[model samples]
Target: MSSGQQEHEDYPVRDEQNEAELQESEAGDEMKPVKIPPRPKRRPRKRKFVAGLLAAVLPGAGHLYLGLLRKGITFIFLLLLDIMALLYFSSIGMQINVPLLILLALLIPVMYFYNVFDALQAADRILRFPEEHDPEDGEDIKSAASARRRVRITEPGISFGVMLLAGGVLLFLFRQKPPWLQAFIENSAGAAAAVLLIGLGVLMGIREVAKNMMARAGKERRSRRIGRYTASATLAAVGTLLFLDWSYGTDDMMLLLKWWPVIPVLWGIEYLLIYLFSRRSKPGGTVRRARMDLRGLISAIVLAACVFIVTEQEHYLHLWNRVSLNLTAAAVDYGEAEGHQFEKPPLVVPVELNTSKVSIDAINGDILIHRAAVEDIEIKATVWVDQLDGVLAEAIADQSFVEVSEGTTIKITPQSKAYGESGKRQPRINLDISLPEDRRFDLNVRTMNGGITLQNVEAIADISLETGNGELILHRIFGNVKGKTLNGAVRARNVLGDVELGTSGGDMSAWEVSGAMKLSTAVGNIKAYDSGDAVDVSTKNGNVEVAGARAKLHAESLNGRIHVRSADFGGDWEVYSAVGDIELFLPLTGNYTVEGSSGYGDITTDLPGLVIDKKLISGQIGTGEFKLRVDGNSNLNVSKY
Candidate 1:
């Protein structure tokens, strides 16, 4: 091409190249990533009060807020079952285990309140913590140093309260003047040790609970609390050993020693739940993986060792082979009772009177006294003229349980002698008194080695009978019947009377009575069948089953279940249990308000309008008044009816 033509072409080519370069630069600018705006954190709804209120009314309702279908349904099902079971078992004549029933009852309030608090807390988190709601900022903020430092600790007042409680218990012992107290006082060391151990246990338990509430979720706090519990338990075991060896009889000592193994098992179970269930709730909670508390483990091992040592006592081994699978009755003594019974003349001694009181004293024989239409005093005895034998009997009777006074007071007493009246074989003289049934009279009889049978008797005054090792049978007796036995059953039937009977180691049953009844037993079942009037019954180591009882009811048991059925309910009823379930089988239409509590278990009921608050289960049925307490362990399946 010519020079001018070449210059033009070059200009056009250069211009085109410059345009392409500029266009490429512009495209590059368009392709560069844009600076995007960040998404805003979700603003949680403030519905804590509503959520908690719903949960309180019905367990698992709060979980529904989180759209947790399975959890919510499970909570409702379990809670409803707990309460329904209470009503069902009670109606079925207690065809179920008492402890299990009580445990189910206890779950009502526990789960109910737990869900309430849980819902409230969860609502607060969802509403107040927007940062935590964001996926990018999911990491939890570290807790404040001050928050960790603030801890709840047992104060000086708690220690003082512990001392006061100890003192109060001791005072009660003295005031009650129980038969066992005399023996306990004679052995001061054992009594002191028992009291000390009880105090220690109570104080430590209080301290531990407080520490748990105050302690932050950390290994150090857990270890410290474990050490405290272990130390307290060790002290209790040591004290128990000393007390058992010095004071408690061989049987009681052996039983206590064998039960020591339960301590470690319980401890292990509790710790297992704590560790296995512990989870990180907040983001900062996972800053470091939670470690097993070595100190706590060490203390727990020490506690186990102490329990083992207590259980493996040398003295208990000899009795271990004879370990009774069935618990012995508290009042009934096994193995033949070795004692001398003087056979008095088998005679009917009836003392007719200007005074409506009849008194008779005996050394050792059954006292059979019944009325036979006689108006005056009749001494129908084998005339083995008895004297208190003030000098000889007192000196000879190694064990005499007798007390009688002169005058219009009817008295019967036991005369015990290590050596009987020499060769007399004391004629077996039983009293069969004849009295006019038209007039009522005050009657009192007592015996040591034989039973007391009072039949076809009518008394204007309170009739009292006592025995040391024999049964008491009363038939068609009028007036209040007060009977006590140390080693026998107390039974009364077809009597228009107010019954007050107590036994240490035998069953007690009262049927069809007119007035209120009070029955107590230490180691036997108390059964009241088809009886009227208010009933006050208690047992220390046995079940209390009331098939048909009415009116004001007060029943208690320390180590057994309390089963009650009443059609007539119109009084203040108080029911208590230390380690057993309480089942009430009564019509729902009855007018009675129920107030109940469970310490370590659950309180549940199926009846509508029942309210469960934490450890409390309360509601009004008709409109009477009553109170019940179940001091079962945590998750204790017990509720007093």
Candidate 2:
């Protein structure tokens, strides 16, 4: 230590000797004074204003202009994603969670303003502290505290990205609408909300845990904050209530609305009592004020909004019904639910046709055509309505009448002004049209929210019938038939012409048809018996049974069984089912070849000489002239009867 001090003490003596030698040596040359450059000027305020202007024009452009590449790129991406999500939700016609949509929509403006403010703040920081705000020295600038704050600020973006991605996937699925997803959407609205809330809570809890771990790792003081779990707890409770409603069809939403004051009370208690207690009992024996959490307030508002919406959805529906006339009162079945009935006086309208065709277009009513003894077409109209007072019903019925235009063809239609006022609460006009037996008039009838019944009317021309939400009953019709309904059944018996019928959610049954029968339904059974020429039957979610069908047969069912028994195979037959069995019965003496295949199912045949494997069958019965193709996911049974 003494030697080191002596050396330190001798440093000044050596320096003085060097200085004296230099002064003697510098006598021959001149030494110039050193110069220092001035500091660079601060950036102009005009440039800062331009950056803010760019941010106002577009979210992240100002950040890019200010040379903050990472922030600029992130903000731009977030803006694009937000705009894309908004456009998707607005354009998509599918049923969405409206509350969630509104919340996301609210975030767009919040994020936009945040971007502008952040850009301006960054520019100001750069102007004030140029050395500290070096964009190129991002790694050096990102202290642990700043990095943590950045993570906290961007956490909402991560959550939003997850939500947007999920919503996009759901929207895609809704568009495609596979059976399972459709069912889930139809029955689990509350459950879906619950799942969303649970996911958000889990993300928040995980974030908090990660932040605590990070702080601990950095040896920072850990302070337990009140309302840290309050938001999560509140969301969980509300989500559980909604899920219970969906699971058990309960009125918990209304119950929650009734006792909603409890939530705020408990939230206040946690924020006040717990925070004060935790502040006093510190781990290091030092008191620190815990920062207030506004998340609980936000969560409470969202929960209250959701609760009110669910509880009073019926009133909103009624208001919507009033605003949107396209929404029919038949949607609510006001006729049965309102418990008031009114019937108008019957009106008989005699129609005379110059041509052979008679067309009837009616709305919110049924059209019944019957054989009459009179020579001309006699129409008896009766109007029945509910949910209207006597005065309104009388006025509606007085304006309702059948207009018969006897031009080249006879057109009979029921018109009512009530359709404009009360929407589908307009009078239900039931027309009993009695057609003459001698005059063979072609019948064309179409109606909405009502049925079409043609009973024992043999038309000379083609019989065309359509209804929007009612059945098409064709009994003993002796003409070519074409019938369609969106939400009702199609039943045709003893039809002596080509039959083509389709329905959306009702069964199709054609018995003893003398001509070709083509029938289809989206979610109902199809049964065709004794058809001719050709027979095509298809259904998405129901069974298809054809017996004594002597025609070209094509039958398919997506999730149900298909059974075909042919009196005689007139043409090639093809039958298929995606997830059900297919049973084909042929005549005992037929010259036909059969080929069948199955997936994970047995392929069996009782015919004489047919080779059959577990999943395939290919053989000829007699002459091998005709072809029969059968495919299914389950069993494929073929037998000769």
Candidate 3:
């Protein structure tokens, strides 16, 4: 004990010099200043109105000015393509379509406004915000808490299921072109939705593994949050992919459906994995029950309802074939051709030098035409007789059945002779004619109950072929070709000039035509491929499919489907249907504005400013250089090639 300690009695035993030294050290620590860190630097805000004005000069210049590289590049590429298409089509002798011009005019100004709006949004984004801190966590106080309120979705798996369910309903109500699209969605949409649900459940297994590893580092809560987000993202992506596949037509529905059972098996395996991981966690770590994702179950129910409406109900086709099945009226024969047919050596008649036009009128046989090697036009036909009347037999016996009559006109078909029986029955006759290839003359051939084939024929004047109950085939016709059939298909290939073909009860397909063309069918599908210029194709009760048609297109269908692929819209396009889905497959860089509506369905498309109102779907894709007006009662899907 020191003398200073004895004097105070209550203080610790210490020397006087030591106590004074400790007091001086305490005063020095109190005089030190507290240090405060500097706040982070923030980005400068740009004026939205000024940025928008710059965009008016070029489509994406405004966005580029605001440091958005991706959005600016996208806008530039789209606008450039629009200008290119317009100039290219103009050089091909095609007239500038009015609707297309108007669309381009409006799109330029609207884009300017949108660029300004986008820049305004970017300027208002917050760079840094308030954070959180726990008083008990002294070590964590040195770092920013980075606390933020996020939307904690309840059952993210279930939410994804609802998205898929809504998609199914939309697909069923809106019929889109490309029959493959509907069939794939109907067969595979369910499987895809189910797989996604199971995929989310599998994330729970991953979480368990991560939780065990994190528990060793005392970060179990972090692992839990990560797992929750991963699971939600998995489910969300699955639902988004379904819609993306429909928009791009890239789903492997057939391949995926091959092993649908694996979807459930994968979930079972995940459950086992989760169980093992949970056991490996820290002693005091919590383990919650893994709930079964209900998303798949919801998708299943919705898909079932949609399938019933699409297949068993036949909703789209019933618009055309839903007549009462009652057979109250007596059946009436459609009148079959009944007559004894007579045959003779094929007649070969040389046309007079002055002949310039040829006409053939046959009652019930096919008409075929080829270029004859001879110097003059020749005719070959089979003579038939049901009753063998005197006038008919006399006309056939003599080669005068076909002779040059009026100036330059050759009449091969004999005048119609009523065979005294019911006017319904006519003698079956087949006519095969050949003409010089170098000579171009007017030609007309008509048949009541047979097909017509014109091969490699060049006509200076109008060439017409008509059939009542058989197909009409035209190959390499150089002039204006008009072909029609009442109960058979119509096909034209390598037609050089304008062509028009129509069929009442069969399909109509045409290809390689160098001029404007029109083909329609009443009870069957219509397909036209590799043809340019203006085209008009329609079908009343069957699908209408067209590919590689690069011009103005007018396609129509009632109670059927309409699909257009790889069509270059150099002019206006009008596509309409009653119950069938309408699909227009254009290149990803296609520039057009589609303005139309659907009565009972919605129009689905992916574009910058797409607006879907009640029965109305309108949007500007790319630069909107062209106009595509599609109207349908069921569904309309626009896809990128």
Computed on alpha carbons, the lDDT of every model, listed in order, comes to 0.59, 0.72, 0.61
Candidate 1 has an lDDT of 0.59
lDDT against true structure, model 2: 0.72
Q: Considering lDDT, which of the candidate structures 1 and 2 is the better prediction for this target?
A: 2
Task: Quote each prediction's TM-score.
Answer: 0.40, 0.48, 0.44
Per-residue C-alpha lDDT of model 1 across residues 26-58, encoded as one tens digit per residue: 999999998989996555564778777778877
Question: Alpha carbon lDDT of residue 600, candidate 3?
Answer: 85
On a 0 to 100 scale, what is the lDDT of residue 446 in model 1? 57
lDDT for each residue of candidate 2 in 1-641, tens digit (9 for 90 to 100): 69989998777555788988888778645665556988875543436898899999988888888877667766776666666666554444233334445555776888789889998887876665554454544445447555554443323246446655765675566455466654565567567877777676666667666765675454565555556566766666677777777788666766765776776687788778756665564455666456657765576557647655643453233232222222333443323223233454544445555567788877677788988688677777877655567677667667877887875467887876554343645567778888788777777787766889998888785887766678999888889987777788889999889898887789899899988888988889999888866898988899999998776788999999999997587688899999998888888787778888999888887877788876789888778778889889998888886
- Model 2 regions lying over 4 Å from their true place: 1-353, 419-424
Query: Order of candidates by lDDT, top first?
Result: 2, 3, 1
> What ranges in model 1 sit over 4 Å off?
1-353, 375-429, 600-604, 613-615, 624-641
Instruction: Evaluate residue 188 in candidate 2 and report its C-alpha lDDT on the 0 to 100 scale.
Output: 71
